[model samples]
Target: MIGSKRWCGVAVFLVLLMAGTHVGIGAESLFRHFVKAKGDCLVDGDQPLRFVSFNIPNLLLIEDDMEFVRTNPWRLPVEYEIEDALRAVVQAGGTVARTYTISVAREDDDPGTPKHVLAPGRFNEEAFRAMDLVLAVANRVGVRLLVPLVDNWKWMGGRPQYAAFRGKSPDDFWTDPQLREDFKKTIAFVLNRVNTVTGVRYRDDKAILAWELGNELQQCPREWAEEMASYIKQLDPNHLVAGGVQTHELHDWELESRVIDLVSTHHYEGDPMRMAANIRAAAERARGKKPYYIGEFGFVSAGGIRYVLDRVVRTPNIAGALIWSLRFHNRDGGFYWHSEPAGNRLYRAYHWPGFESGDAYAERAVLGFLRSAAFAIRGLAPPPVEKPDPPHLLPIPDVGHISWRGSVGAYAYVVERAESPQGPWQVVGRWVDDAAVSYASLFSDESAQIGRKYFYRVRALNEAGISAPSNIEGPVTVAELSFVDEFADLQRVFQMGGQVSLGALGARAFKEDLHRLEMSEGAWVRYWVPGEIREVEIRAFGQTDSLSLELAVSADGQEYGPVPVVQRGFRMNGRDYPYRVPVLVSGRIDRPGCHFLQLKAAGALQLGRVEIRYE
Candidate 1:
């Protein structure tokens, strides 16, 4: 296989390796390296590796004072809330989990220093003590903790005061024997920190994915990162050493220069596709020594997040990506980050699970599909471009969004929704576009009664037509309903059959009057006709104004009698069948008091229900 021999050489080498014949140094070394860096050949491990870089925002949500979470209703220690988010990732198609934090409340401009802070409780102990709880949760969930090499400190003394103490750059500190000794000791401590929750040791736990040296090394000097990388390799050689590279700092190669285990970076720019290309280019300079990971990529909302994921996952040589963070339910605010619907939304479109509150199930529709595919692709030949789950109806209350899955080529999709599992169903959304499955729409319910259940289903829509419904998905209850009725019925008037209805003598009528629908169902509606009339009447709100047929009749619904004023109209409002226009009559008629007048309807229709009252 060396020196571009031919396909035959690769076949021969594969056969020899299978036979345990011990091939030549050149072939053997290349084979082993490929096998190890890629994955075991026996299994289909060619799928790209998936690593999610999450800035857990752990400490931020902790007590605002950097105390226990209980004191801060808005904050929960990472241990209490991170599992669901990570589990969401696992369900979404992520393979590796990495987390970060601010440690303590400090100035945004403060010089980051690798020092301990004076805080009470276990974290106050330093290293293992400071992040014991975080490390514990990481172990419990079987993931890794990305400990920032700096602490949150005050910036009041200005950048110089703090930088001087913390080492103006990586060079200022690592080049000095005293500081280098301290840096090495810190690395040793970090590598040794164990997770007590799962009984899985730090270096031992397969869960501890990788160690990120610094969140974004460009915050310091590139030379400092070079020193830090060397220190890390010398300290711990087993796990992957990563620098949380930011997109803005892609040019910082100090960490990349050393024999680092993985090339990692973060992107905050809205474009993941462009960012992926940028990150891949930077990672390629590593000479294929290690794979690349997007540790801190995130979107401000669901759409952006999903789009970025699709772009990054499809890119060549990309290991995987992690959203910037997860946090308690809230409106959009805070640092340059993005979260799941279980987290926040920047604008209102359709309803999503994480919109107002968090819904773990909605998240699973996407996450679960991803995890399954990731598992399938590990070490196998890189799969044709894959997709997240298609938008299928779930027996859930609403559609958080819809997506498709497949290699980049022709694809079909279907959408379905229902009040229950075994009953009437409706198709709300569908597409045959070749775009990979991803977030599509927001599903919400306003009329759903609390505690009531609903169902949904999806099937592949192909060249012929719609396919059979996938499966009965259901049991989504209307958790809450905030009906404001701000617009009233002023918008489009909906009728059962898209037509007007008339039934029962004297009791009902159509084409009655002109009046706008208002917030109060009982508000009055008025109209006008040109001409005179001894009597006048109109129908509305499922009922007629009255049966007074005295001296009123007209060929034109707009005109009534000799008196031009008779051609005028009036109106009323009340609960009645919708889409049934009120009927009006005016002008002299031979009959009087309660006489019946018949008016023909143009369409046959049935109103869900009807209401009528005096006009």
Candidate 2:
């Protein structure tokens, strides 16, 4: 699996190309079709408006963590990776995915100041390459993109003069004339770059959503905010621009007032309804300036999703919402529940019935609302979003075992499996309620032989009507499977050291023994070996005393137990030892599922060589 960091770099690059082109259609052509077709306002056609967002730990751009990039290196591979990540969203029904990238001005060469963000566009090869890849990916996947270019990277782009007026203070960065020029240039570079994703050079894609100027501008001086907002409007008239305002900060509104095309807020509090109300009031009080949206909002419980949607949908002028993130880390003390795909929950609930997550209530409630909304949005409706044909549908969605997020009433699809598309079809599973239309039909060929082929199709029924069968995909064969496990070798030889730093020694011969011994300090090496796996082997030996060749094992890599010692009749340097025990021990690593397997020396034995082979 590719690491998330490289994926993030790809997102950053895509944001640079956001304003390249504009769609020719006006608000009437787009939104009229949507309202007539029973779709969302932004989705001017039969398709549901696809909006998705991910919280990329862009800060991790500089940090090193094995978990973030296990197989893929941090240096971006290409622009397509960004598209690849977005493709996942597309498949999940998202037409837009937001990334907190140009949240600030970025410096290319590490400008050496503590407060300066890097302006690496001029010097960083990786940064440039990653940016290029992002455009390519967005073009490939059919999703509109949004990037909040102001925050952290802003102060880095030579806008030191503007920085002086930041926060409540007015004399820090605004006084620097050179800093002001730098900031202007930085904005020009970004605004002028053509977004390859939309085909129109930096000023054209109509599908392009909004260019969020600042993530949250409590520190952004009101004057500078107005200045930048005006510049952006004059610079790119086609796209909407807004600052991703933080909670209820009126100081931000001074800047929020003039520069933004829309008022964007990130609301995720105990009560999303209450939060939405406050923001709605703020937008309304702005008079009839622009639209308002809960650009980002989500909570620890998936149930909060319902509350948020309920409030936003009821608000008169609010356009739509973009969940703060589809997936994020638990390390930051935030919830990670929104990561699930739409069809997952329903399938799980079909099997496990009452599996509750914080958002269970909301997820359950949303299905009926979506069906109602889909039916109600007549002005936006054309033909309804197209579902893939028969061969593309899963024959047996494990509905009973699905999670709540995937259990939408509208997704309940009927799956029919057959030896061939033209032959007899059998209903593998069924859910008839209008809400069931939201359930995705998932099927598998447990009986399918390795190289065997099969075909499938699905049908869904919502209040708008039953969709035509999805397109046919294959009479295709299931191919063999394999895992590259590029880091497998590195994980081995990760030894708990006896006297020296095993990491230092392993670093020298990393290619050779990366898995067996990791650098650690102790008398014995305790390496983690997974159980129920039979493709690998481990063996250890002592060169000196044969009697000291005893071995101990532990379920957890930390605590070890004694293994029966057998005396070998082999003596070294005339020592009366007769232990030449066969080192080919063939017992399974006796640990429970998901437990760690550890091997240790029995006595004060001279550690020789340990080998693992996959046959």
Candidate 3:
């Protein structure tokens, strides 16, 4: 008899299979379709299977111990980090995820440590177990995983390590008989491995949507990719296979390959129009031959994200699009990989719940576009022709207040209020005519009681109907005698090093009243508290490790001491907010002194606002 764990796995698989059938397009079953490439589109049993996915390359690489392989035989602790990342994808209305490099190497390098490969023909059981857990979690969460077999660059010991094993150059690994056999062995090992947690073999797992031959294997000949894809198909006939090629490597043979199931392209152009145009062109090229996907796209603004998403959703042949990545604070405390600094400054992984980041634009807008597009691609009824932008809600001392940037082509706006974030919300206000103009819209709840929290959201309306609701921002308690310095008027008191600038930007903060303070190693910022302060609350956008802030206070404006505060982060509705860091220095501030506050940061930091509660 199969073990209980195995039975549970099967049970879960069946439930997911049933769920897939229920949600399948055009009243068809996804199980019956199995994501086949039909006439340049991925179809599910006569229904199109269009998807929006995110790249979480380090899903299998647990943050614990960093051991290349699990040396301990016991089940590796299931890291919630991976689940959290997957949750972000799902919450954003994504149904698929494409992970980054899964490396296999003998000796671990500092930057690229934790190689999954112990040696040629020898495999790391621990690393394999981690992947097993990933699939198990993916199954439970109902998100499909598209796993790439190997990397092309040395970052993951792809081609170079294969050659290094047999004393050959990276180029020779493609043609060398021994290297080719070694690669095949690796493929077999992965394809046949049984999951220790779920008790299901990798080949039989339905959670896996596709098997990628390799990531960006441009240096390798088309024949190599075709051969690897064929090899994978032979081992696991159930899942689809992709070459993972970009536009540059789009050869006719590769597109026409019988084994390859999908054609993928990567784009990172700065211009939104150009990126959309490129995707359109690629989709046109792949039409009627194979399904097309923008496998990777990033380093663009929120508008760029919208532009590209619009193009992909409108294209009939394109299967879907996956952003470059999504990062979780619990994983390595922050972004665990190298991202373009410029992109980092503009856009990072779409954080869970809050969706706000240090990026130049609000991710709420991007998420709205993505969620709508995802629905549209899956053959769901299209969302309103235009959705209202997320409203910005702030607590004005002794008053109820909310504001929002206006939506284009919207004739009216509706503001909704609720007692709780997840709530039975009621419409509070509706504005039209001059009131609905962009950046000129504002609402004040005159009856909102002081000291009581409230939540607010906004939606735009046109001739068609009401758009999707904006980002919910509240539970903001109206306070008495609270001095709020939105950082809009504050001058840079001190900038030790790194880039620091203040601006009224980001949808999460008060209108045009946020600051972007970039810090390097050993960098710090000092600000003067406006009045006698009892407590201080700092609002900012940050990932756990990538950007963190330390607050210090001084009575004489000279000697500073660390302030005690508990930093609490939260996720709601597919966005993350590290908002609960409050410094209660009542005694110090009540002493008729303590005027200056200093912030010291170890890693990159973005300072948003500083609020002081006083007598």
Which candidate ranks first by TM-score, i.e. highest? 3
User: Which lDDT tens digits does candidate 1 get at residues 1-615?
Assistant: 123223323432243234222222112111111112342011012322344334454432322111111111123334323333333333333334555533332223223222232221113233344354544433333344444554312211112222344546434543565555555554565556564443434554333445666555455455666677777666556455556445443453633455545656666655656665666575565434456666665443345455555555455456656555443211111111122322232211111112211122243232333333343323222222223323333334333322222111113454566786776876655553322101112233333455566666665543334455666665665444321111113232211122232232221122211122211222212222222222332222323323222222334434433211132222322122122333233333342222222222222221221111111
Show where candidate 2 strays beyond 4 Å: 1-81, 88-94, 103-129, 136-142, 152-175, 195-200, 249-259, 327-615
TM-scores of the candidates are 0.43, 0.48, 0.60
CA-lDDT, candidates in order:
0.37, 0.39, 0.60
- All-Cα superposition RMSD per candidate: 18.7, 16.1, 12.2
Residue 249 alpha-carbon offset, candidate 3, angstroms? 6.4
Candidate 2 versus the native: TM-score? 0.48
Lowest summed lDDT over 10 consecutive residues: which window, candidate 3? 66-75
- 445-498 in candidate 2: lDDT tens per residue? 333334556555556543444555544435755442111111223344445445
Candidate 2, residue 592: how far the Cα is off, in Å: 22
- Clash totals for all candidate models: 61, 120, 17
**Model 1: residue 545 alpha-carbon error in angstroms:** 56
Q: Say what the RMSD of model 2 is.
A: 16.1
Question: How do these models rank on lDDT, best leading?
Answer: 3, 2, 1
Clashes of 2: 120
